[model samples]
Target: MHSYAAVLRTPHALSTFGAALLGRLSYGTVSLSLALSAKNASGSLAVAGTALALFGATSVVLSPVRAALVDRYGPRRALVPMAVVYAALLTVFALVTRDHPGAGTSAVTLGALAVCAGACTPPLGPTMRTLWSQLMPDRRMLQRAYSLDGVAEELLLVAGPLLVGVLVAYAEPAAGVAVSAALVLVGTVALALSPVPFPVRRGSGRRGSARRERTTRTRPRGLMQPVLAAAGVGLCLGGLDLLAIAFTERQHQPGAVAWVLAALSAGSAVGGLTYGAVSWRSAARPRLALICAALGVALAAAGLAPNVYALGAAAAVAGLFVAPALTTAYLIADEAAAPDARTQAGAWVNTALNAGISGGTALVGVLVGTLPLFLCFVLVAVPALVCAAVTLHGENHRKRH
Candidate 1:
C-alpha cells in the first residue's frame, strides 16, 4: 500500500495509471462486443466466433510491430494516431454491422474492418509497463507496480464483460461496441497526453548509431526464455477458460461457468497483491521456475477434480501463482533485453501470450468435442511444466557461465 502510494505520488503516475487502466478495459471489452455484434448481425454463433478469432489473430500478429514503433518514435508520436484510427475503424464496424444486419457485403466488410482495428489498436499495456520502469527506479516498487497492474487487468477481465453484457441487454449490441471504441479513444489519447516522459532509445539521434549498436551488442542471453514461459502461462490460462465452460456444461450448470472462472481471476488478484507486498530474497529466474511448477501442480489437481466445486477450488489455487510468474518474467525480460529494445521486448511478451492463447483455444476446441475434458486440463499442465523446466535449465546454464 505504501509502495503504491509512493509510486502514484510520482509525477503523472496517477493519471497515467488511470488512463492505461481505462484503455485496457476497452481492450478487454473488444472481443465480447465484437462477438455480440457479429452474432446479432449474422444470426450465427459460428460467424461471431470467426470474427473474434480473426481479431485476436491480427492483434497478436501486429503487436510487436506496434511496440517497435513506440520504441523508435516514442509513445506520444506513435500511439495517438493509431488509437484514433483504431477507434474510427471500430465505430464504422459497429455502425455498418448494426444497420446492415445479414448483408453479405457488410459481413465481409466487418471482417476486414476488425482486422484493421486490431492492427491499429495502440499497445497500451506494454507502454504503461515501460512507463513504470521509467517512473519507479526502485526494483521493489517496480514489482509492486507491475503486480498492481496485473490485478487491475484481472478486474478488467471480469468487469469489462459484465459492462458489455449490460449495455447489450439494456440498450443494444452496437451501443456496447460504440462504448468500447469511445473508451479506447479517450483513454489512449489521455495516456498519450500525460506528462510522463517516454523512454527515448539510447543513441537514437546519432548518425549510424543503430548499425554500430547492433554490431557491438553481444548475443542476448535468455531473451526468448521469458517470452516462451509467458506463452506457456497463456496456454494454461486459455485452456483453463475453455475447461471451465466444458465442465459447467457437462454438469448442466452452465450459468456457474462465470463463477468458476472468476475464482481463478480472484485468486490471481489476491496472489498478486500478496506477492507484490513482500520483498522476496530469491532470484527472479528461480522464483519464476518454482511458481510455474506450483501452478502446474495446481492445474493438474484441477484436472482431477471430481466436481465443479472442486474444480473451481483447484483453479483458484492455480491462480495464486499466475501473477508472480508473470511479474518475474517481465523482470527477466527487462534484465535481458538491450536498452534500446526494452519496449519491443515487452511487446514480444504480449505477442507470445496472445499466440499461446490462440493456439490453446484452437487446440482445446478441437479436443473438447472428441475427448474427455479432464484431458484438456492435463494438456494445459504440460505447458507450465515445460516452462518450469526451461527456466530452470536457463538458470543453470547461466550459473555455469
Candidate 2:
C-alpha cells in the first residue's frame, strides 16, 4: 500500500488525489445528510427517501446535458459554473431543511432544489478516470493509481457518513450538507487550477471515415458498452442500498447503518487491492465480473440471514467483487473512448451506473411496504444475475466478433 506521505510527495499526484478525495466526500455525505435532514423535517422515512432519490435521479438525468457542455466549451469552463451552482443549492438545502422536519411544502421545495443542484455538478468519476488515462505513464502504474483511488473513495464513503451521523448525534443534522458544499467548492477550485485540466490527447481518426470505419471505430462504442453494463450493475446496487437501509431500520439500530454499508465498502477496498495485483490484458474481460455475480448472489443470501453477523459475512462476499468489476469496466471504457470524448464517455458510464442504482432504489423502496425483506433480496439478486449474464455475453461476443 502506498503511504499517505508517498502519495502527497508530488504536486501532480497530490492534485489528482485531492480532487478525487473531495469529490467522493461530497457525494458520500449526501445520503446521511439527506436522510437525517428529512427525518428531522418530516419525521418520516418516506420523505427522507424522497429527498435522497431526488438528488440521485436529478443527477442522472442532467449528466448527459452537462457532458455536452463539457464537450462544447471545455471542462475547465464548464466546471466552474456547475460547481458554484451545486454549492449554492446545497447551501439552500442546509438552511431550508434544518427547521422544517415535517413541513411538506418546504421539504418538497428543498428536495427539488437539492436534486437540481446535484444534477448540475459533472460527475468526477469520469473526469478522474480520464485523468488516470492521461496522467499515468503505464498500465501497471495506472492500476496502482486507480487502486489507491478506490481505497480513498471507500474511506470517504465510510468516514463521511459516520461523521455525519456523529454530528447529527451531537450537534445538528444540517452540518453534513454544509460540510459537503464547503468541500466541493474548495476542492473544485483546486482542481480547476491544476495542470491536469488539459486533455492529453485529442483527435478522431474516424471523424470522417467511411461506413466501415464508423462501424468498427472501436472507440465510441467501447465507451458506451461500459455505460450499458454499469447501468445494469447500478440497478443491483440500488436495490442493495435500499435493502441495507430497510434492514438496518428493522434491526432497531439505525445508527449502525454505516457499518452495514461499510461492510460492502470494506469488501471493495480488499477486492481493489487484489485486482490491482492482477493483469487483465483484454477488453473482453468477464472473469472479474463473474466473480461479482457470485458475490451478489452471496449478498442476497446474507440479506436473508437470521442475524447481523451472518449478514455481514454475506456482505463481505458481495463487497469483494465491487472494485474488480469497476476496475474492469473502467479499463475497457478507457480503451474504447475517442480521445476527445474520453471524459464524457467515462462520465456517461458513471451516470448510467448511478441512474440504475437510483432507479433500483425507487423500485425497491416501493416494494418495501409490500414485500418481505428476504423477498426484496431475491428481487435485487435477479438483476445482479442479469448483469453477470450480460458480462458473460460480452465475453462471447468478443470471441465471435
Candidate 3:
C-alpha cells in the first residue's frame, strides 16, 4: 500500500493516471460501438463483425507508428491533434451510419473512417506506462504502478462493454459511440495538458556525444521474444472469453455469461494488486515463464470443468496469473528496448496483444460449433504454454551466448 501511495503522491500522477485511464476506457467501447452501429445500419451480423475486425486490424497495424511519433515528438505534440481527429472521425462514423441506415456506401465509409480513427487513436496505455517509469523511477514503485495499470485494464475491459450495452439499450448504438469519442477527446486532452515531462528528440548540445553513447548502450535486443510472448498472453485471454460464453450458454445460463466473465476479471484485478504489493527476488523473465505456464495449466483446468460454476472457479484461478504475467512482460519489454525507443517497444507489445486477440477470437469463432468447449479451452492453452517454453528457451540461449 505504501508503495502504491508513493506512486500516487508523485505530482500530477493522479490527474495523468485518471486521464490515461479514461482515454483507455474508450478502447473498450469502440469495438462494441462499431459492431452495434454497423449491425443496426446494415441489418447484418457479418457486416458488424467485419467492421470490428477492420478496426482491430487497423489498430494493430498503426500502433507502433503512433508510438514512434510520440517518441519523436513530445506526447502533447503527437497525441492532442490525433485525439481530436480520432474523436471527429468517431462522430462522423456514428452520424453517417445513423443517417444512412442500410446503405452499402455508408458501411464502406464507416470502415474507412474506422481505419482513420485507428491511425489517430492515441497510444494511451503505452504512454501511461512510460509516464509512470518517468515519474516513479524506483523499481518497486514502478512495479506497483504497472500492476495498477494492468488491473485498470482489466476493469476497463469489463466495464467498457457494460457501459456500451447500457447506452445502446437506453438510447442507441450511435450514442455509445459518441460517448466513447467524447471520453477519448476529453481524457486525452487532459492528459496532454498534464505536467508530465515526456521524452523528445535529441537536441544539439555539448553532451550530445555522451547521450548518444548512453542510447547505444541501452538499446534493446531480442525484442521479438517479449512481443511474441505478450501476444500469446492475449491469445489465451481472447480464447478464454469465447469459451466462457460457450460454457455458460451450454449450461442454459446465457445470462450468467457476464457474471462468469466478470469473475475472471475480478480475480485478475485482485491478483494484480497482490502481485504488485509483494517484493519479488526473482528475475522477470523466468517469472514470466512460470506465470505463463501457470496460466496454461489453470485454463486447461477450466476446459475440464464439469459445470459452469466449476469453470468459473477455474477461470478465476487462471485470472490470478494474468496481470502478473502482463506486468512482467511489460517490464521485460522495457528492459529489452532502447531507452530512446521505449514507447515504440511498448507499442509493439500492444500490437502483439491486439493481433493475438484478433487471431484468437477468429479461430475460436470458426471452431466454436465443431469442437467441444473443453477441447477449445485446451487448444487455447497450447499457445500460452508454447510461449512459456519459448521464453525459457530464449532466456537459456541468451545465457549461452
Candidate 4:
C-alpha cells in the first residue's frame, strides 16, 4: 500500500489540485443555486426547472468539446477565456435574480443565460485528472492521486450544497451563484498561472500525430471500454436517489432518506481512499469490470432490505465500488490516450457518466411507479452488470486474439 501523502508531495500538486477543486465546487453549487434563484426571481418552479435542465444539458453534453479545445490550445490559452466567460455569465445570472426581487423575471431570460453559462463552463475535472497524470508519471502514484482527487470531489459536492444552504439562509439564493462565480474565476486563474504545463495537441506535429497513429493500432471500441464502465456507474447512482426515496416513503420513514444517501457518500469516500492505498497487479479495465459487477450485485440485492436502515446498509455496501470504478476508468483513459488527446479522452468518460446519470433518472422515474421496488432496483442494476460483461468479454476476446 502506498501513502497518499506522497502524491500531494509532488511539486505544485497541492496548489494545483486545490485550485481545480475550488473550480469544481462551483459545479456543485451552481445547479442548486441556479434552480433556487430562478425560482425566486421568476416566481415559477417551471422556469427554475427549465433553467437547471438547460444548464445541465449544455454543460454535460459539451464536456468533450470544451476538453478538446483545451487539448488543442493548452489550459492557459483555452481555460482562461472559458472561465472568464463562465464566471461573467454566472455573475449576470446572479444579478438577474438579485435585481428582479420577485418581479417575475422571464423564464426565457434565465434559461438563455443558463445555457450560455453552461456552454462556457471550463472542463476542470478532466483537466485536473490529466494534470495528475502529468504530475505523477508513475502509474501507482497516479492511482493514488486519482483516488485522492475523487474523494475530495465527492466531499466538495456535499459541501458546496451545504455552503449554499447556509448562504441562502442568510442572504439570497443569488449569493450562492455569486460565490460560485468567484470560486471558479479565482481557481481557474490560479490554475492557469501554475507552473505545471499542459501539453497542447497541435494540428501538425509528432505530438498531434500520436492519436491519429493510434487508429492503426487500436479500434475505437477498444478505447471506449472505460467510458462504458463509467456510464454504467453513473446510471446506477442516478437511479439510486429516486430508488432510495421510494424505499423510504414505502417504509414510512421518509426523513431517513438523507442519512441513507449520506451513507452512500461516506462509503464511497472510504472505498476510494482504501482502493488508492493498494498496489494492484491486475490491469485497470479488468478491475473496472469487477468493480462494476460488485456494485451491480450489491444494488440488485439492495431492493430486498426489510427496513430503511437495512436499505441504507445495502446502499453503503454498493457505494464501496463507485469510486474505485471511476478511478480505474480514469486510469484506463489516461493510459490509453496520447498526451495531446488525454483531456478529451477523460472528457469522453466524463460525458458518458453525466449522460448516464440523466438517463438513469429518467429510466427509473418511468419504472418506479409501474414496477415493484425490487424489480426497479434490478432494472437499474442492469446497466452496470451489462457493462461489466461487455468489458470482460472484450478483454477475453483480445487475449484470444
Top TM-score prediction, candidate number: 4
Q: Write the per-residue lDDT of candidate 3 for residues 1-401, one digit (tens) a residue.
A: 46787778889999999999999999989889988888888777887877787887877889988988887786888988889998999998888777545666455766788788877888988888888888777778888999998898878977899899888778878888899899999999898888988866564576876775666465445466678778998898888888888888889989877777777888899889999999899888888888999999998888878887887788889989988888888888877766566788789888888788878887888898998777898999988899999989988997898
If scored against the real structure, what TM-score would every candidate get?
0.94, 0.81, 0.92, 0.97
**Cα lDDT for residue 80, candidate 4:** 94
Candidate lDDT scores, in order, read: 0.83, 0.71, 0.83, 0.91
The order by descending TM-score is 4, 1, 3, 2
Taking every candidate in turn, the Cα RMSD to the unseen true structure, in Å, is: 2.2, 4.2, 2.8, 1.7
Please report the TM-score between candidate 2 and the true structure. Answer: 0.81
Task: In model 1, state the lDDT of residue 288.
Answer: 90
Supply every candidate's count of residue pairs whose N, Cα or C atoms clash at under 3 angstroms: 0, 6, 0, 0
RMSD of 4: 1.7
Error of 4 at 272 (Å): 0.5
lDDT of 2 by residue, 374-398 (tens): 9888788776677777777777887
Residues 1-401 of candidate 1: C-alpha lDDT, one tens digit per residue: 45667867888889999999988899778889998888878777777777787787888889988988887788788988899898998898788777545554355666788888888978998888888888887888888888998888778878998899888778668777898899988999888888877875645456658653663364145567779888999998888889899998988999988888888988899898889988888998888999999999899779888888988888889999998888888877777766556677788888888788777887888888887777778888899999999989988998998
The residue pairs found clashing in candidate 2 are: 40-101, 41-100, 41-101, 41-102, 42-101, 42-102
- Candidate 3, which segments miss by more than 4 Å at Cα? 99-105, 203-220
Give candidate 1 misplaced runs (Cα > 4 Å): 103-105, 202-220, 369-371
**Candidate 4 residue lDDT tens string, 1-401:** 55888888899999999999988899889889999999999999998999999999999999999998998898999999999999999999999899576789988899899999999999999999988888998999999999999999999999989999999999999999999999999999888888887878766677647756774266356557999998998899999989999999999999999999999999999999999999999988888899999999999999899999899999999989999999999899888887877888889898998999999999999999999999999988999999899999989987899
